[model samples]
Target chain A: MSDSPIDDLIQTMGLMWSADGGPRIAGQILGYLLIEGEPRTLAQMCEALQISKGSASTNARLLEAKGVVRRVHPVGSRQDGFLAVPNPSHSLLKSVAKRLRVQADEISDISARFPDERADAQRRIADFAEFYRQSADFMDEWTARIGPARGETAQES
Target chain B: MSDSPIDDLIQTMGLMWSADGGPRIAGQILGYLLIEGEPRTLAQMCEALQISKGSASTNARLLEAKGVVRRVHPVGSRQDGFLAVPNPSHSLLKSVAKRLRVQADEISDISARFPDERADAQRRIADFAEFYRQSADFMDEWTARIGPARGETAQES
Candidate 1:
């Protein structure tokens, strides 16, 4: 294990997110920001992680676009700083539900294109679509049950 | 769109599953088998998908291992046949819950390594772990609610 707890956490998160198809460095940056609990300039992050300024900048932008990270500006500092966004879990779940809905819609459209004679095949496709649609609906309900304010309160306790 | 509805469905499923980090060919095979609703020999799958026998066999084994597809043997048939496994959505949700549990465990272990002075970081890590843990629990409850028999009955209507 690394001497620094933060370093270990960053590496672990990087691997975890990479398993879910995200960029490793972006995950690390998010991990670092979450642990720091304060905005960090691109230069500072690059130095801390020993990565190039270009890589750090690129990933910071990507993470921001994903709604898990945000850019902040200090009162007098010219350089922009980045921090992990609050309520990331909610954002992630919402995006996942959105994607699943798109997939379900596509499956439904494809099923409709089939002839009535292909009932079995059509039924299978419809089932697949329903599965995704239901899963998305479940996410919506779950999110409402665990709304951001309540989630934060739960975490504080 | 292709003249064959099967082809269009397979392509759409291929894209959807590939986005979730699964092999595109494996998704296509799963889609094809689900629609075919009958055991298909490896050669037939390859011919229909215009893929090599090697690729078809490899993806079929992969899907089978994932529990989304099953191998079937007909009486006195020399060649092995494959079909989509029943209750695949249940299996998939269960597997996802399992993976989330593993992630939560990892996060917990990492949190234990943090020093007392790193309280903020430790809290954030613990919160992250909790999110995954709760999500896994949700999946468990969801899976039980949609058990195989119930799921099939619902689909029939």
Candidate 2:
């Protein structure tokens, strides 16, 4: 309930996370975990984000499955808590790259159904997808070079 | 049509064009116009961009309306054709900024309806939208400084 910049930051992130890229809801949970700063209980997330508890739980679990955020139980609490890995910008980039790859693949498959008529379009799709793949790889390298924020220290993979 | 790299380039371009950060058929038309090296007839675009004649006509008009692309008649022919300006990367930055602006305005209007309890969440949305305005401006400046592609010159507005 405190006025924190992180609250704004969280919502901004949710806009991106909730971005369907076509039509999607994944963005909300990513945004919440992103600014929570530490692992938080489901109740905290639902209250803070003003989303239904079921929605919070579902999206939180989705983030964990994608390896963008993780589930970590606090020492004395029975309730499950979650934390996003430090340097989530890298996570964000990788997620985008992976999804783009899927899109590229789907486009390619669609092109395939059209026979030789689509050969050219198929090639273009594959080539551009390759561009995105390289772009994503380049981002991974670039972010790693920039390293973590001062004092936080980078966590080794 | 011949196997012009430009055609593959256009096909790839079409595939790569995004509206609001997601791909749109309008983008491909813009890409084709950007690189086809000359204004293309409605016939040429329909063939190259792989859209219907009506779709090409409709989208090209929309692009013209947006000031991103233009309609032109060939030197002496009666054919209707179009040309795309070589915009800088910052053009994308600016367009994205514009979309964020619209979202921000929507937040302001939407907040007026929330009586009390939901006021904070609406405020969060309004703040979130404001942040993108600053971000979009920053991106536009940064992109302008970066300049255009190596060999391709961009005409500054």
Candidate 3:
């Protein structure tokens, strides 16, 4: 643990993401941005998170593509800034639901190729496909109920 | 892709799993069992899946631990068999919900250590914690609504 609680928390985020099979430095950059609640340049992120400039830039862009971070141009600022998006989990959930739909489609495609002798197997595959498809729909509904996404005004439920 | 559609499907499964950062052999074993919908010995799995005994055994055990496959013993049979669990996605979803709960706890713990000057950061952390906690509960409810697990009789909805 570091002397600063903030650093300790950032390390925890890094470790947690690594445990989930993600890059540790990406999680660290996310943690730093989330806690700062402000736009930071690539150099600033590299300095504060103690990560290499290349690592910071790469991960920040990755996070931006994933919808958890944004690239911003502050007034009169020469360098671009990175800021953590509000409700980052929503985007992650969206990707997961998309994956489930893909799995469902793949399962259905495979099920169509099953031999006549494996009728039971086809039935089982059908059930699995249905489960994944339904799960994707459920996830989409759940995320919708979570309210607005980043930079959007809240709407009436 | 292989000439046999079944083999092609299994290869697809392996590729998908590897893409997701999981063991490819495990996904192949799962695809084999899932298509057969019957228990087979490790030796049989190795021979049929064209995998080594070590890879087949280890990946089968790994799939078993993940609740996607189970070890079974046919009556009067000396050797054990591994069968794909019905509705395996339910267990995977359960594990995901459990992980969300862990994340919520970690975020809450870290939020407590933030200094007074970072009240806005604390609020954002609280929002994230709330999101994770609610998501865990939502996943649990959804999975519970998915009907029976492995070997259980279907109940009237």
Ranking by lDDT: 1, 3, 2
DockQ per candidate, 2 decimals? 0.64, 0.11, 0.55
TM-score of 2: 0.53
Per-residue CA lDDT of candidate 1, range A4-89, in tens? 66788889888988888778999899889988889999999999888999999999988876667878889999999897875677
Candidate lDDT (C-alpha), each: 0.82, 0.56, 0.81
Candidate 1's C-alpha runs over 4 A off are: A1-3, A149-157, B1-3, B149-157
Give the clashing pairs for model 1: none
lDDT tens string, model 1, B96-144? 8889999999877888888899887788878878889999999888888
Off by over 4 Å in 2: A1-23, A30-72, A77-80, A83-157, B1-7, B18-24, B65-67, B104-130, B143-157
What TM-score does chain B of candidate 3 reach?
A: 0.85
After TM-score superposition, what is the CA distance of residue A55 in candidate 2 from its true location, in Å? 8.0
- Off-target runs (Cα >4 Å) in candidate 3 are A1-3, A152-157, B152-157
Across B1-157, the per-residue lDDT of candidate 3 in tens digits comes to 3667678777877887776668998888887888888898999988888789999889987777767777888999998898888877677777778888999899888888899998898888778778889999999998888754765222212
> What is the per-residue lDDT of model 2 for residues B1-157, given as tens digits with 9 covering 90 to 100?
7444445445554555562354466777865665454678888988876779888888887676555665676678999878764442334445555665665565455444544665555554455455445445544554465554333322324
lDDT of 2: 0.56
Order of all candidates by DockQ, from best down to worst? 1, 3, 2
